[model samples]
Target: MKDLTILCGVEACAIFQNSFPEQPTIWPSVGEANRIIEKFRSLPEFERVKRMINQETFTEQRLKKMEAMLKTQQKDNRHKEFTQVIIQRLDGSSAILPLKTDDDCVELDNVINQFIKDIDRKMEILQNEGSSSNPAPQVS
Candidate 1:
């Protein structure tokens, strides 16, 4: 039995065991097992059978079980619609603003416009200060 178990490592042997569980054979030696495995692998149906075993099982009962599991999970979970406004800056920074109502969108627009105006005003002040300090070398 232990010797037969070792032969299961071969692909053909494993497929044979799965396909015909009732009739199990014990090869006299590993070389004999290898020769038989080679013959089985040479058959056209070997790859097909291997693929069938590896593929997902989609039997009717299995699908019904999966559907029930999904329904149960859905019942336990709370689903909500989320709305967000993403602001991306030139310096590779980002801000996400979540909105719950129409009024929040209107308020967000006003806030963003005011923020741009503030930045422009600060830039103008900086430019004015830079020009005054330099004075363009008197430009006579």
Candidate 2:
């Protein structure tokens, strides 16, 4: 997969992207993504937790199992957010496999973070190009 590199070094050629070797999607996906993430960030983590547990096993035993395992996590604040993404990707679609462990969740979080940064940068550049009469190409 190619990625979008908005910020670059002084050389403007050091930013590497593997996902977006060509151009970005010609849609309003970035701003919508930012808005969605903003809304997700504002919600309580428990909301995602409930959503995850809803379609899966919500037994007290299972909850305790996950709770104890995640008790020492430093990502409690981002848990719901990460969880929401996991569920959305895993459920009602065959695009991605479901996250069954904390490790999977971590990996997914990293992937999502990179995607978010890349997309936001791409959208920024595209928007700037659309509005600016003169645009300088950023080395990638």
Using TM-score, give the best candidate's number.
1
- lDDT of each model, Cα atoms only? 0.59, 0.61
Q: Write the per-residue lDDT of candidate 1 for residues 71-135, one digit (tens) a residue.
A: 77753331211112323433355644556677557656665676689889999999999989887
Error of 1 at 5 (Å): 99
**TM-score: model 1 vs. ground truth:** 0.32
TM-score (all chains, Cα) for each model: 0.32, 0.28
Model 2 lDDT-worst window of ten: 8-17
lDDT of 2 by residue, 1-140 (tens): 11332343211112233596775552235565566556666778997455344434667768888888787474553555565665676676434545688886776778678778988999999998887966668799
Off by more than 4 A, model 1: 1-95
